[model samples]
Target: MAPATQPLLRAALLLLLLLLATSHQATGAVVATELRCQCLKTVSRIDFQDIQSLKVTPPGPHCTKTEVIATLKNGQEVCLDPEAPLVRRIIQKILNNAKSS
Candidate 1:
């Protein structure tokens, strides 16, 4: 190994390490944000006939509010307000059906 080139080689290695660390932190921040929430807005009501399916996600460490996502027959999804009276009644009905089964 030539002494004259040793410093340049060390500098290149340090730069590479710094780049890697910065990218790792950026990627981690993206992943953390992705896990935080899935719904930003909620509607108080939806046409019952248009709904094809429903997904209910209870509050957890990632979010503090209960999320109700409905997939319409036309393939569009919307978030329903869990606190709405109609939504609450529907949820209770579904739970009762599940329990009876």
Candidate 2:
């Protein structure tokens, strides 16, 4: 190939590779988001015993559901449904523990 044409070809190849990489990363991000959404939707219960801390966020005007954010001993956070019976019990336990201390 001609020297002038070689530079242009190399540039075109590099651009193609960059586009492919960007597209792949975007697709991966979409898939990960979808999976996380599915997991959140399907989360009905959690082990309250492992929870180290809990934070309750009051419901907003648009929504009437309060969010209970539980931080586990391992530092992982999970959002719990406040209306759940088990979650209420867990919250009570935490409150009792605090009061006793």
**Reference-based lDDT, each prediction:** 0.69, 0.59
Worst ten in a row by lDDT for model 1: 24-33
Which portions of model 2 miss their true places by more than 4 Å? Answer: 1-42, 61-63
TM-scores of the candidates are 0.59, 0.51
1-101 in candidate 2: lDDT tens per residue? Answer: 88889989999999897555433121122111221221132134777667788777676653455666666687756666677788888889888988999
lDDT of 1 by residue, 34-60 (tens): 455556567777667777878898899
Backbone-clash count (model 1): 0
Residue 52 shift from truth in candidate 2, angstroms: 1.6
Cα-based lDDT at residue 58, candidate 2: 73
| Residue pairs in clash, model 2 | none
Model 1 stretches astray by more than 4 angstroms: 1-33, 99-101
- Indicate the residue-level lDDT of 10 in model 2: 94
